[model samples]
Target: YINDVCRTLREEMKRAGIHAEVHAWQKHLASISRKLEYVPRQSNENPLSQLHDLVSFRILVDTDNECYLALGHIHALWRPKDGRIKDFIATPKLNGYQSLHTTVFCLHDCLAEIQIRTHDMQRTATYGIASFWYLKDRMGKEGSPNSWKLSYKEMVTWIEQLRQWQQELPESADEFVEAFKGDVFQDQIFVFTPKGEVKDLPRGSTPLDMAYRIHTDLGDHCAGARIITNMDESGCLVTRQVPLDYELKGGEIVALLTNPAVHPTRDWLHFARTNAARNKIRRYLKTYERESQQADASAPVPGCQTTTMTIHAQDRPGLFRDLTAIFADGGINIGSVSSTVQERSRAIISLSFHLPPSLKETLRALLHQIQALHEIEHVALEPHDDTF
Candidate 1:
């Protein structure tokens, strides 16, 4: 069975475009004493049949994404036993173990347990996080990417939660367990983009939430979801438009549609399912809000030919340099410049500039030049009513 599983895994890896040398494959049989000791305690009607993990197989890869790819390949190859699939990667155990586990019917219709995890996860599972940290130190990769550091942080968070629970002192064990279920444990679903990349979202996440997860612009201009069905011979997708409020069931392939004319409305608050999404919508709405108290904060300067303009752009280094360079080329002096950066990494720059008679006549042309600068999204004269 070991030989058969190994050969099959190699073949599947090849089919999945995973080269031979990078991944690790291992198999083991439970020791007799351990199996004997485990069975009697469970008191199964038939101990022999109850032990599904007697023969265990492991496929260790490099990254969390590859773990899911391996899982897809394995499930495609074999029929998994009913109710045997467990996704520990999305929700790591209190001990920081992460894996994708499933029991499959292998050769001769015999049951075998398969565990898929990243190599780092396999190390943590085998020798705990300290050993992983030590191995990383030996390799001089302690600070590179530092994926294990995230696990360490999660461990610390769990310890802190435990301490908080102790201080709070739950009235009973049942209450403590309930608190754990409500706080520490969360229900999440995995969905795929039209391009097949998986995204883990909370159980009740809507398509609007998913759109925001993909990008702030995608969410800001989101029209609705286009549920991808399949591609035709011409390579165009056949998709059904779903409402932004539509709740997701795991495994749905979704494509968010956008309209440049569409923008967030107060109605969106009722549909948004994630705090990130809801907050982005609120920020966008407030930016163009007509009733905003600060709407006239940049009221026309007295005795000066000035124009108040607000430029919306993506936040990045050297962006101000490019913007200022454009105005300098136009030979215009900025009377005043202030910026408000939003939580979603968007920058709104309000610039008050002396509108010379020549510049005023060619204001549209000058604004066009500023708009052409990379990273700049919209350049609108302030105190104007405009949607996103």
Candidate 2:
């Protein structure tokens, strides 16, 4: 059954114009035993029949880019089993292994696992970093002439980096092993930027994580992600803004839309996957809170109450006219007004209004009115007493 599946898969690849070498194999008993140890005891199933990779086909391609191109073709050819596809090529194993794996129900109800990788990756999977020494040991090259030896040494350095992560993580041996299986060995999702650059994130990462991975500034200003996905019934591509809590998946192209007035929300900490992303968000929040406190302390004068209202909204010709008219109708005197038009047809307006003792209670209602206006996205009011 495995052989027939491989043959059909190779034929499909040929039809789809994917050039690669495909090798099929059945797992040895010893290898199967080692794998069974990792399986949860709760699964009361036979390890042999349940193991998807027991009967597998490995396809070697030429480049990393071609791996994804081939993956699209393969999915178009076969109906993948639910939750059976894994993309290790984007997020390589801690041991520096990379591949694209998928299990599908092929002919005769046989479940076959297919592993796709580059030729270099296949060598790494076989002998790991020692694969380079294999050529040198046979060819007697001592003059640093073998490029494979140099590449293998580089792989060793990366493996050492993985060891550093293991040391830094606070986990027992069993826990660490489980984490390794989950974070490194499990399937990964790959998202693409507007420029087509691939970002390998954990399976449930949000768009905010992608922004932080790109740059701290971009992440700090990230408003949302415009994701292009195949959601239409006619198989057409649709673009929409992904909610901050949305979990991203593989092969989705995301274009980040940034707004200067937008900042990280507290709930983002719950969804950020990477440590860098979480740290960046925390730092931004801390700095913002500190600045707000300082401004509250120093912005007010003696015997007077002052408040600042920062408004973010869509840019319109009569926006200022409408805002000032509201202030005039409310009998509030604006001390000063500053506004800046930004990219993406947005504007940031900051207003300092003097709060007389009589009108102190109406300040909150005035801010609420501004927030309820059309085109307004956000409104923040800060008031301080100068009686100190």
lDDT of every model, 2 decimals: 0.71, 0.72
Ten-residue stretch with the least lDDT total in model 1: 20-29
lDDT of 1 by residue, 1-388 (tens): 6787777888887889764333323334446556766666555476667778777777877677777788777766775564466667765677788777777777777788888877677788989878866876776554545666655564465566556554443345654555455445656566668787776666678888888767789898889887853333232435688898988765557887889999899999899866556666776887868655454444443454667889899999998888878778876667688999998789999988766455554666677788888888888885442421
lDDT of prediction 1? 0.71
TM-score of 2: 0.60
Question: Which tens-of-lDDT digit does each residue in 1-388 have in candidate 2?
Answer: 7667778777877886888888888899999999989876656766667688888888888777778777767766654554466666555567777788877656765677888987767887888847645765655555554445544544565455357446634435654465455545444677777776777766777888778767789888888788987573344567998876677866678988889998887888887875546666776798999998866544544556777888999998888998888888787777788989899989999998766676765665677778888899998777543331
Backbone clash numbers for all candidates listed: 0, 0
- Once model 1 is optimally superposed onto the true structure by TM-score, how far is the C-alpha of residue 209 displaced, in angstroms? 1.0
TM-score of every model versus the real structure: 0.47, 0.60
